[model samples]
Each structure stands twice: as C-alpha cells, then as structure tokens.
Target chain A: MLSPGATIGVLGAGQLARMLALAAARLGFKTHVFAPSADEPAFDVCAARTIAAYDDPDALDAFARAVDVVTYEFENVPAATAEFLDARRPVRPNPRALALTQDRLVEKEFVQGLGVETAPFADVPDAGALARAVAKLGRPSILKTRRLGYDGKGQVAIRGGGDLGALFRALGGAPCILEGFIDFVKEVSVVAARGVDGEFHAYDISENQHENHILAETRAPAAILPETAVRAKEIARRIAEAEDYVGVLAVELFLVKSGRSERLIVNEIAPRVHNSGHWTLDGALTSQFEQHVRAIAGWPLGSTARLGRVTMRNLIGDDAERWPEIAAEDGACLHLYGKREIRAGRKMGHVTRIELE
Target chain B: MLSPGATIGVLGAGQLARMLALAAARLGFKTHVFAPSADEPAFDVCAARTIAAYDDPDALDAFARAVDVVTYEFENVPAATAEFLDARRPVRPNPRALALTQDRLVEKEFVQGLGVETAPFADVPDAGALARAVAKLGRPSILKTRRLGYDGKGQVAIRGGGDLGALFRALGGAPCILEGFIDFVKEVSVVAARGVDGEFHAYDISENQHENHILAETRAPAAILPETAVRAKEIARRIAEAEDYVGVLAVELFLVKSGRSERLIVNEIAPRVHNSGHWTLDGALTSQFEQHVRAIAGWPLGSTARLGRVTMRNLIGDDAERWPEIAAEDGACLHLYGKREIRAGRKMGHVTRIELE
Candidate 1:
C-alpha cells in the first residue's frame, strides 16, 4: 500500500476530482490535478495542477512522475493518455476498464459475456446499419454514439418515423448502438469499490431521477426490495472482478417490476465516482470519494453502512440561484461547484438532506 | 452575505485553515492562505498563498485585496496583523476578540464580567507581582504568559516552595497570569458559532483529554450532566454576544463536581476553530469549519446535530505511523494534515470512530 503522504495524480479538474482531492487530503495524501481547463473547480484545492490537454505527452509524463498512482474522475479520459500513464505509473481501474466502458457496445458485450442481462442493443456503424439495428430493436429505441457520450449527449431517440439516414448523419456517422427501452419502474445504481487485493465493497443502492436527460436527484437505500438490492450489488461485484477494477465503479440498473415480482436490468457502467453515489457523502459512514482514494492507494476498504435515508438534489443551471434560500433551509446540506459561467443544463452544485432511519 | 463565489482570506496556514479552505470550496467559495512559513499544511489546499511576515504591509495589503473577508485559525495572531487586516476588510470575530483572548487574565475577567464562573486568576507583571500573585492564587497554580501562549507553552506550574525570583526570570519576567488549579472531573468545551445577524448555534459539548498539554482525545456529548452542558453553552453564547463574534469560537471549561452537584469553570477561549471540536467533521450534521464559513459569510447556520457517540484520538508525531492499521479498522475516519516532518508534540493527524446512538 502507498504510504499516507504519497501524492495522487487525478486526470480531471471537475467537481468529482475536487471532492476526490479533498478526500485524498484528509487521508494525508496530496493530489495533483491535470485538466485542459485552467480554472476548473478542483484547481482551487489540489496541491498541484497542470492545465494541459489529454494528449499532451510532456504534461502526462510530469504528472506520472509527480504521483505514486494515477486515477481519473471521468471515463472519457482519452485512451492514449491512460495508456501513457499506465506505462509509467499504476493507472487504477486500469486502461482495460476504461476501454470497456468507453464504448457502449463493447461494455454491453462485456456484461453479456459475464452472463448479466442488458438492454437489448445492436451495433450501428453506418446509416445502413442504423436501419437494420432499429428494425432489430424496434421503434422507441435509443440510438447513442458508442464512444464519448455522457449526460444524455450524442443520443437520438427513435420514436415515430423519421429519416434514418438523417438521424445517423446527425451524429456524424459515429459508431452507435441502439438500445431497446425497458419498462423500468425506477432507475437505480450500485457504487462499489475493489481493492488491489481483490476485495470488493458496495454501497446501498441509490434511486436516481433524471430531468432533460441529466441526473436530477438520488435517494439512497433506494426503495427497492432487499433481495433486489443484494442482486444488484452482486452484479456490480461480478463486473468489477471481471474487469480487475481496483477503484470505485458504479453500475446503473433498471429496476423493472412485472406484476408482483421485481428484477434489476444492467443499464450502464461508470468507471469512477458516480453522481448517484453523492448521497453517500453525507449519508454513509465512508463516502464514495474516500473509498475510491483508499482503493487506488491500495488501502483496505472502509464501512459502507448507511447513516440514514437521504436524498441528494442536483442544482443545475439557474437552479443554483436559490442557493441562499437552500442555505437557510434547516437540515439541508448545500454544496456549490465554483463554476463561474451558468450554462443551460450545467450542474452547478447539489444539496443533500438526510433523515435518520 | 458574501456570495458563493467570494474569496475568503484565511490569516493562518495551519490545519484549521486547511480545513476551513476545504469547507469553503464545498460551498463554492475560494480561500487564500497567509502565513509566514513557506511549507505550511494549509498552503497545499488553499486557492492561493502569501508567504510573508504577518507585519509586512505590502503582503498584507495584497492579501486583503485578493479576498472578500479575513478570518484566522488561531488566537495568537499578532495584534498589529489583525488591526491591519481590519482596516482593509471585514475581519470575522473582530479584533476585539483577539485583544481579549490573547491575554489570559483579560479573558478570565471578561468571562467573570458576563456573570460566568472562571478559575481565580491574578496578573504578574514582574518578580514582585509574581510573588503576590502566587500568594493569592496559592501553590500548584499555573503561571502562563499573558500573550502568545498555547498548547501548554510559556507555562510554569508552581508547586510547593520555589525561588520566586527564578520562577519570574524563567518566564523572561514577561507579563503573566497565575490561575489557581481546580480539582475538576473533566475538561469539556462548547464549539459554537455566531452569525453576522447575531444568530447563535452550539454543538454538543466535547469532553477533552490532554497529553502533555496537547489535546489527546475528544468525545462528543460529554459525560457531564445535561444541565451542565446547557449551562456551558449559555456561557459561550454570552461571551460571543459580548464580543459580537462572527464565526466559530470554542469555550474550554473544567467540569467540577462536589457533593452530587456539578458546575463548570471557564478555562480558556479560542476565537477560531478548536482542536477539541475536530470530531464535528464527520460526527455532526455540519462541521465546525463549515459553520465558521457560513457565519462569516453572513449565511444561516447549519444544523449542529451530532451523528452519534464519537471518539476522536489525535495522532501526535509518530502515532500517525499506524495509519495502515487504522485504515483497516472499520469505521475509523482518519484526517491527516499534509505535514511532512513529524516532530514530538506536533499534531500530525487524527482518527475518529463513531458509534450511532
């Protein structure tokens, strides 16, 4: 295990990296943040920061030399950057995990290979393939870019008749996957961490809500049955073990109910700290950020016991304008990301409220 | 109230300042740290740092210009430094609090003036004064410098007979205060905050244990009588109001029990976040650092509800060497200040374990 005073290099300078850096600091570990943006949120709190593009060889080399282990906040970190860092330092959650999750089709296949069920999907590499894929998945399926898609971006919802070639061209003819829609009662996720020793721990399930395709809120100990929660964690554990993941990974699942029976469907995977787990910051014994730090540092996992039932509401866009009122609200824990510009649908911050069970 | 993106200038670059900066960042505020030392712990996490003597006018002016308001980590911030910043920006807890708490005798008198009980104390300006003060306070009394004393420094205990002149010279014959020893059952403190709008909130009393005059351990919701805890908070509220304090303050008290009756004797006042209250970081709804930031920002105070029965043990010097074992210990929340050198009596880190009540 890396010693307490070891330096950690993080490859993103957003709020997730910001909280990860803060958590690393609490463990006597200093963090160096590397991102293209000069004034990202994590820059304000990290010990050192490099403002360079993902493909900058010199910056990546320096970052590797400066840290004992390299980790990242988002899955979209360029493949070449991860490979470069992996060659020098230990890149946690490994480059393979990144490659698997970076492409939606590859990720779905990987899960299916492990005997886990996923939303029915088909590969669409061209406009001609889009028609066949849509026919296989049926109408009302989602055509999403296989690579570099996040927060409901690079997606085209196929409902009624439209120009299939126009839709494929709209996404720049990028490799895509058509995912069949599921009649899920709720969307839930399991944020789990795996140690270098192969030990795995998962937090309680989080029920997620979305607005405009962006995460709106998350309630933890998600109102799912106990058996379903256990099954969801088992699936996440299996995925982590299969990937040889050595840090936090989140598995999003669709909680579907048919009559009186309920089951979980594997939806997607996030290779780092997930927004659905933000409730753990205030509602769990050990926060997901701290857990990720520990796992990447090769330290033992901490307790994932929930403190209570909690709800986390994301403050998006102009929603952050109510921060003053939120601060005044009793028992409401407010967090605001230091983002200067408020663009539409941008996540500005979050507030969590916990009710002890 | 200062807006979320405002920059807060913290005057001392220590663990307290580092924690305050982290908390400020969580609320979308930035922090600039000012300290004389170049490699202080707080510098690693602060948005900016100014390494210069506290009395350097140019550095002080530049720092003031860079921040929205000024607050500090310790009570012994030089009087001139506080005054200089006061002239340029709004200084939380005000300069008067520094003037009052910097002198032990003055603080005792202020507590007494507010109809609160305090240990009997006498001022010693010279050898003659020392003799008279020792006679009035009696043997086993502690003679501490009136200015710049902390963590048992600049203190001499008078037990039995000794050369009075030598004792005076031992302390450099500087102004001092002789406090009569109290036969106390325990040492407890109320970590409280006062908002700019005069709103007051206090956390549950923390029972403190000292090793070599440095805080060794603290357990919240101290074992004192319920009424004693309420009375202790009342005393702190009275003191904060008298000082018109904005930001967190700590009131250390000696819980004395006699004939089944319990009462508290005021021991000392810390105008900033106190070491005894560090457990609030994970054991309370809102940490003391966040409370200080909220109060100084003119924001409403957060809930001070304790999470459970918690114990915090300071990892002094080499005690931090057991971090690996502590990491494996379930539910032990470790907080290590990023200090490289570990010296005897230096507070290197701490571990907190919480048990839900």
Candidate 2:
C-alpha cells in the first residue's frame, strides 16, 4: 500500500493534473507533475515538476525514480512513454487502457463488445469507405478522427447530401468512425472509480448540456428513470471490472426517448475524471479527483453520497469574467483553472450550486 | 469587490494556509503565500509564494503590492508587520484584532467587558500582584503569561497551597493572568466568520478533547444542552460584531454542568481558523478555511450545514505514521501537514470521518 509522503507522478500538467495534485496532497501524498510545456498549469500546485519533452529519456528516468506510481491526466500518453515508465515504476490504469482509449475505432468496438449499447458506428479509412459507412449509418452522422480528438476538434458532420470525398480529405484522410446520430432528449454520464482490489464506486448520474459540442452545464441526478440510472452504472461497472481499471472512469451516454420508453446508448468512455464530474468536487461526499487518487493509491473507496441537489456550469473563456456576480450569489461554489490567458474555447473554470431540498 | 483573477496574499504558510489557498482557487482567486520558512506546506499548492522574514520591509512591500488583500493563517502577526502591509494594502481582521488576540490579558478583559461570562481573571505583574491575586482567586488556579501563549505553552498550573512568589518570578517577571479554574464538564468551540459587509455565519459547536494540552480530537454538534449551544453561538456573534471582525474566528467555551443546569463560559478566542474546526473540510457544506477566504474577499457566506456526525483527530508527531492505515479506512478523510520532521508535540496532520445518522 502507498504510504503518506510517497510521491505520485502525473503526466500532462493541465487543470486536471493540477486538481489531481491538490487531491493527492489532501490524502497525505505528494505529487510530481511532468509535462512537455514549461508553462503548464499543474506546475503551480505540485511538490516537484519537470518541463521536458515526453521523449526525453533523462527526465523520464528521473521521474520514474521519484514516484511510487505513475498516472496520467490525459489518455493520449504515448505507448512508448508509458512503457518506459512502466519498466521503471508501476503505472495505474495501465498502458493497455491508454491504447484502447487513444483510438476512437477501438474504443467503440470495445464498448460494443462488452454487451453495452453503442450508437451505430463504422470504420472509414478512405473516401470509398466513408461513402459506404454513410450509406450504412444513414444521414446526419458525425465523422470523428480515430485519434487525438477533443472539444469538437477533428470532427465533420455529414448532413443528408454533403460531399463525402471533400469531407474525407478535409479530415486529412485519417482513420475515422462514422456514427449515426441519436435523436436524444439529453446527454448523461456516470463517473465511477475502480480500485486495484476490484472495488467499485459510482457517483450519481449527471445530465449534461453542450454548446458547440463543448459542455455548458451539468446537473446531478439526471432527469431519467431510476432503472435507467442503474443500467448506466451497470455498464460502467462491467467495463471497469472487465478492464481491471484502477482509477476513475467516466461513461458518457445519450438518453434516447423511444415511444414512452427510454434507452441509454454509450457515446464514449473517458478513462480519467471527466468534465461532467466536476460538480462532485463541492456537491458530493467524495470528489472524483480524490477518488482517482484513492484508487491509484490502493486505498478504500470513499462514500459517493450526493450532498444535495447540485448543478455545475462551465465558465468558458470570457464567461469566467462574471465571477464577481457569481461570487455574490448565495451558496454558489466557483472554481477557476489558474491559466494565465483567456483563449477562446478554453475551459477557464466552473461554478457549482447545491440547493437544499 | 475582488474579481475572479485577483490574487490574495496569505501570511504564515501552514496547513491552514494551504487549505485557504485551495479554497481561494475554488472561487477563481489566486493565493500568494508569504512566509519565512522555505518549505511551508502552503507553498506546494498556491499560485505564487514568497520566502522572506516577516520583519523584512522590502519583501513585505513587494508582497503587499502584488495582492488585492492580506490575511494570515495565525494570530501571531506582529503589530509592526501588520502595519507595514496595511500601509500598502487592505489587511482583513485588522491589526487591532491581532494585537488583542496575541495577549491573553487583553483578550480576557475584552470578552468580559462585552458582558460575556469568562473565567475570573486578575493581572499579576510582580510577586506582590501575584500574592494579592492568589489571595483573592484562591487555590486551584492557572497562571499564564500575558502574551505569546498557546497549546499549553507559557503556562503552569497552581495546585492548592502552591508557592505564589516562586511561580511568579519563574514567569520572567512578565505580566501574567491568574485565572480561577472553573468546574467544567466539557470544552466546546464555535467557529464562525464575518464578511467585510458585517454578515456573520457560525458552524455548529464542536466538542473538543485535549491530550497533554494539545488538541487531540473534535466532534461537531457538541454534546451540550440546546440553550448552551445557542448561547455559544450568540456569544461568538456578539464578539464578531463588536470587533467588526472580517475573517474566521474561533471562540472556545467551557461547558459547565453542576447539576441539571448547564452553562457556557468563554475560555478563549482565536482570530483565525481554529483546530477544532478542521472537521468542516470534509464534513460541512463549507469549510472554515473556505468560509474565511470568502468573507475576507467580500463574497457571500456559504451555508454552514454539517454533512453528518463528524469526528476529526489530529495526527501529532509519530502518530502520522498511521496514515497508511487511515487511508485504508472506508470513510476516513486524511490530511497531512508537509512538515519534514516527527518531533514530539508537533501537529503532523489529521483525519476526519463523517458518520451518517
């Protein structure tokens, strides 16, 4: 078992890593953040930090020697980098999980193979393949890159008679997945954690709303049937148990209304803490970041009890400038990523409110 | 009003400061920790930090110029130090509050003058005064220095028929307070905060236990009569309004039960967050540290709702070695002060557990 004062090394020094470092400190563990960019956000809150390329062997070696276990904030950790650190120290959520999540096609197949419902999807490698996949999936489909896509980036929409060949080239002709759009009433997610000892814990379901494919707001106890919520959690539990997941895993689902019946179709899996789970930091007994730290440290899972009726709103870019008004609001919990600039589409911070029933 | 990106300057870099920095971050405010120690716990988790002696004028001036307001983790801030920073920027809880709290004699008189019940106390400057005070107060009393006393330090107990002159001379001939001991059943505290606009909020009373004169454990919703609890909160409110305090304040009280009747006597007052209030970090709707940050930053006070029956235990010195075991507890929340030594009597960390009724 990991003891207090032991260091946990984190790859990717962003806001997620910054929060993870803070959580680790609360549990009596220190954090060492490693990122390629020197101006990474997580550096400000870590006991130690290294600004060097992921391929820099010397820096990686030093980091490996310092921490008891290594974890990543983002799933895009290079396989070689994971292997390098895995050879020197233990890596939680393992490199295989990273490989499975880094590729969109593999992630879709993996979810479907687990007997979990996923939207109709087909792999498209070329213009011919795109046309054939579109024909199979029908119109109003989303074509997303197979790798390294986030925040509505590297995605194209094929509405009815849109050109297939130009669309393929527009996406750089990379391996992609064509997903049949679900006419869903809302989007929901289950943020859960699995420990090394096979223990499972899930927070309450959150109903999410998006603007331009980026999360806008998340409210807890998703407006859905209790059975549907149970199924959502079951899907996440099966996936984590199947993979022997040792950290927080978030499963995003599309809630489809079908003639007085409701069904949840898996949209994607985030093998780390997700944006939808940010509300738990102030609204639940155990926060997702702290849960992740507990899992990797091989500790007991915390209570996932929702404290009250909770809602979280993302403060994107310039939206965070309204902090003064929000701070003046009664019982509003505001959080900000300590990034220096206000770039468009960047997640600046969030505010959570818990109403007593 | 302070904006989202405003920086807060905090003096005294301990676990309290670390928690304050984290709380400020949640409100989209940055914390700049200034302390004389190079390896303070707060340094690892703040947006910025400065290392310099409290008496260094240049460092103080630079620190004051960089932040919107100044606050401290402890009440030992010297009058000159607070004045230097106050000249350059706004200092919350003001220097007068600090000066009042740093001296036990002043604090007792201040509380008593407000029509609040306090242990009978008399100032003793020399052997003659000591003899006279002892003759009036009688045996079974406590002799404490007038200034710089905390956690059982700088004080000695005078049993029945003890030497008054020798004890007085041993106290360095400094001004002292000889307080008649009260027959109390339990010790409790009310941790509250006052916003800059004069709004006040208080957490529920916490029953405190001491080991070797150092705090060992605190349980919230202290076992006391309903009226006694109400009086405890009322006393705190009156004190806050009287001082115009704009930060967290802890009022320690003695619960006297001499039959069916129970009464509360004010024992002491802390101008900052108290150890007895640490359970709020994981057990209340708003932590005392976060509440202090909000109040000093001129934000609305959060609800002081306790999550459950909570117990907080301090890990002093070698007791911190049990962190591994503590982490393995299903519902225990652990916090470590990043001090590098295991010296006896040092507070290393604490663990809080919230039990649902």
Candidate 3:
C-alpha cells in the first residue's frame, strides 16, 4: 500500500484535478499537477506543478520520478504520454482503459462486448463509410469524432436535411463514429472505484441533466428503482473488472422505460471522475475524488453510502458571480474553480445542496 | 465585502493554517501563507507563501498589500505584527482580540468583564507577587506565563510540596497569572464565528480530553443538557459581541455541576480555529475553517448544524503512521498536515469519525 507521504501525479489541471488534489491532501498524500496551460486552476492548490505539454518527454520523466503513482483528470490523455508515465510509474485505471475511452467506437464496442448494452454504433472513417453508417443508424443520429471530442465539440447531428458528404467534410474528415440516439426517460450515471485487489465499490446512482451538451445539474439516488440502481452498479463493476480498471470511473447510462419495464443503455464511460458525480462530494460518505485517490494509491476504498437527498448545480460562466448569494444559502456548499475569467459556457464552480433524510 | 477571487493572508504555517487554506480554496479564495519557517505545512497547499520573521516590516508590508484581508491560525501572533497588518488591511477578530487572548491575565479579565465566569486569577509580575498570588489562590493552582503559552508549555502547577521561589524561577520569572483550578465535570468548548455585521453563530459544543496538556480527542454535542447547551451558546455569543470578533473563535469552558444545576466557567479563548472544533470539518453543515473564511470575507455565516454524532482524534507524532489503517476504517475521515518529520508530541494529522444520527 502507498504510504501517507506518497505523491500522486495528476494530468489535466482543471476543476476535476483541483478537487482531486484537495482530496489527495485530505488522504495525507501530496499532489503534483502537470498540465500544458500555465493558468491551471489545480496549480493554486497542489503541492507541485509543471506547466508543460503532455508530450514533453523530459518533463514527463521528471514528473514520473517525483510521484509514486500517476492519474489523469481527463480521459483524452495522449496515448504516448500515458505509456511514457506508465513505464516510469503505475498509471492508474491503466493505459488500456484510457485507450478504450478516448475513442468513441472502441469504447462502445468494449462496453457491448462485456455483455453490457450500449447505443448502436458504427465506425465512419470517411465519406463512404459515413454514408453506409448513416443508412444503418437512421435519422437523428450523432456522428461524433472517434477521438478528441467533448462538450458538443467535434460532432454533428444528422437530421432530415443534411448532405452526408457535406456533413462528413464539415468535421475535417476526422475518424468518426455514428451512434443511433436512444429514446430515454432520464440520464443517470454510476460513479465507482476499483482497487488493485479488484475490490469494487460504487456510490448511489446520480440522475443528471445537460444544457447545451454540458452537464447542468445532478441529483443523487437518481430517483430510480432499487433494482435498476443495483443493475447499474453491476454494469459498472463488470466493466471495471473487464478493463482491470483502478481508480474512479463514471458510466453514463440512459434509463429507458418500456411499458412496465425500465432498462438501461450505456451512453459513455469516463475513465476519470465525471461531472455527474460532483454531487458525491457533499452527498456521499466519501467523495469520488477521494475514492479515486485511494484507488490510485493502492489504499482501501471508503464508504460510498449516500448522505442524503442532494442536488448539485454547476456554476457555468457568469453563474459564479452569485457565489456570495449561494454561500449565504443554508445547507449550500459552494465550490469555485478559482478561475480568473468567467467566459461564456465555462465551468467556473459548483454548488451542492443537501437535505438529510 | 471581499469578492470570490480575493486573496486571504494567513499568519502562522501550521496544520490549522493548512486546513484554513484548503477551505479558502473551496470558496474560490487564494491564500497567501506568511510564516517564519520555509518548511511550514501550509506552504504546500497555498497559492503563495512568504517566509520571514514576524517582526520584519518590509515582508509584512508586501504581504499586507497582496492580500484582501488578514487572519491568523494561532492567538500568539505578536501584537506588533497584528498591528502592522491591521493598519494596512482589516484583520478579522481584530488586534484587540489577539492582545486579549495572548495574555492569560487579560483574557480572563475580558471574559469576566463580559459577565462570564472564569477561574479566579491573580497577576504575578514578580517572585513576591507569585508568592502572594499563590497564597491567595492556594495549593494545586496553576502558575502560567501571561503570554506565549500552549500545549501545557510555560505553566506549572503549585501542588502540596514545591519551592515557590524555585517554581517561579523555573518559568524564567516571566510575567505570570495564578489561576485557582476549578472542580469541573467536563472540559467543553464552543467553537463559533461572528460576521463583520455582528451576526453570531456557534457550532454544537464539543467535549474535549487532553493528554499532556495537548488536545487528544473531542466529541460533539458534549453530552450536556439542552438548557446548558443554550447557556453555553449564549456565553459564546456574548463574548463574540464584546470583542467585535469577525472570524471563528473557540471558547474553552469548564462544565461544573452543582446539585441540580450545571454551570460553566470560561477557561481560555482561542482567537482562531481550535483543535476541539476539528470534528466540524466532517460533522457539521459547514466546517469551522470554512466558517472562518466566510466570516473574514464579510459573507453570511454557514449553517452550523451538526451532520452527525462525531469524534475527532488528533494524530500526534508517530500516530500519523496509522494513516493507512485509519483510511481503511469505515466512516473515518483522515486529514494529514503535509509535515515530513514526526518528532515526538508533534501533531501530524487528525481523523474524524462521524456516525449519522
């Protein structure tokens, strides 16, 4: 087991990394945040920071030597960067999990191959394949890039009137995947952790809402049936075991209701802490960030029991200006990202309101 | 009112400041830790740090200009240093509070002046005064230095057999106060905060246990009667108002029971976060550290409602080596100060166990 003074190296210095570093500190571990941007939010709270590109070998080597273990806040960590760090130190949740989640097609295939249900998807490498995949998936489908896509970026929806070749050309002809949209009742996620010894623990399911393709809010316990919640956790456990994943991973699922039966279809798998699981920070016995740190450090996972009925609202853009008002609210836990600018659509902070049962 | 992105200048670089900085970061405030030690624990997590002597005017000037407000983790902050910062920026809890709490004689006088009960105390300016004070207070009384005393340091008990002159000389003949020891049922503390507007709030009282004069453990709600709890809170409120305190302050009290009535005698005042209130970090709606940040920022006080029945145990010296075991225990929240060395009696970290009620 990793000792108290062990340092954990984190990639992608954003709000997630910031929270992770705070959690690491709580667990008696120091954090070294490495990111390309100098204006990283995580740098403000971490013990050490390296403002360098992920692909810089010398920087990566030094960081690996400095830290006992490596983890990332974002899934899109470069494959070569993961390998380089893995060679020097244990890269938690493993590089295979990162490689699987970085590509839309591969992630879906991997999930489905594990006997888990996922939205029907097909690879669309070029216009010819796009035309074929569009016919197979039908209308109102999402054509997302196989790599480097997030928050409604690098993707286009195919509706009634849109030329297949033109739509393909608009995306810069990047390797893509076409997925059929699922008619779902609600979006839910399972935030779980797997230890090196294969001990799996999942928090109460979280029901999520999105605005403009970005997470807007989350509510814990998900308002889902107990059996469905159990099934969601099982799905998460199966995936973690299959990938030999260590650290917290969030599986976004679409809860579909058909007559008297409700089923779930996997939407996406985040190889790191997900926005939907932000509610866990205040609503659960142990936060997802802390759980991730424990898993990466080879420590025993903490309790994932829900604290109460909780709602987490993201403070996007200028919403952070209301921080004072939010802080004044009873039972409201406001967490700001410490970002200097409040640009439109930026995730500036989050507020969690918890009501004990 | 201080805005979200403002910087908070903290004096002292111990675990209390480390936890305070962590709490400030949660509220989007950057912390600038100013202390005399380069290897201070708070330096690891703060946004900026300055190492300089407390009496250094140039360093103080630069630090005061950089932060929006000033606060300290320890009450022993030099009166001159507090004055220096107070002149440049507002010092929450104010310099008057520092002056009052730094000297035991002044602290008792201030508390008694507020219609609060305190142990009978007499000033001992010299050996002659010490002998007179001891004669008045009687045997088994405590002769404590008026300033710079903590964790059982700078104090000696006058038992049945001891040379009064030798005891006086042992403390370097410093200005001292002889306090008659009270026969008490329990040692309890009220950790509270007062905002700039004079709005006061107090957490549930915590019953504390000390080993070798250093806090060992604390349990919240104090096992006191409901009426006594109300009375304790009232005492805290009165003291905060009297001092015009604008941050978290801890009032240690001796719960003395007589027949059918229970009364309290003020022990000492910590003009900053107290170790006894550490349970609030995981047990209350808002932690004492966060409450301190809120109060100093001129923000609304957070809810002080306890989340559960909580116990906080300080991990002193080599006790921190049990971090792995503590982290594995269910419902235990481990927090470690990033100190490398584990000298005997040094506080390394703390663990809080909360049982939801």
- Local distance difference test values of all predictions, in order: 0.93, 0.88, 0.92
In order of appearance, the predictions have TM-scores of: 0.99, 0.95, 0.99
Per-candidate interface DockQ score: 0.85, 0.53, 0.78
Name the weakest run of 10 consecutive residues (lDDT summed) in model 3 chain A.
A21-30
Against the true structure, candidate 3 reaches a TM-score of: 0.99
Off by over 4 Å in 2: A257-261, B169-173, B257-262
Which DockQ value does candidate 3 get?
A: 0.78
- After superposition, which runs of candidate 1 have C-alpha atoms over 4 Å from their true positions? none
Candidate 1: tens digits of C-alpha lDDT, residues B1-357: 999889999988989999999899889999999999988888888889999999999999999999999999988888999999999999998999989999888898899999999999998888889888887888899888898888898999999989988987898878988889899999999999999999999999999999999999999889878899899999999999999999999999999999888999999999999999899999999999999999999999999999999999999999988888999999999899989998999999899999997
Q: A1-357, model 3: which lDDT tens digit per residue? A: 888778999998999999998898887788999999988789989889998998999999999999999999999899999999999999998999999999998999998899899999999999999889988999889999999898889999999987899998889999999999899999999999999899999998999999999999999978988999999999999999999999999999999998968899999899999898888888887999999999989999998888789999999998988987898898899999999999999999999999998
lDDT of 3 at A99: 99
DockQ of candidate 1 relative to the true structure: 0.85
lDDT of 3 at B354: 86
Q: Each candidate's chain B TM-score?
A: 0.99, 0.97, 0.99
* Residue pairs in collision within model 1: none
lDDT of 2: 0.88
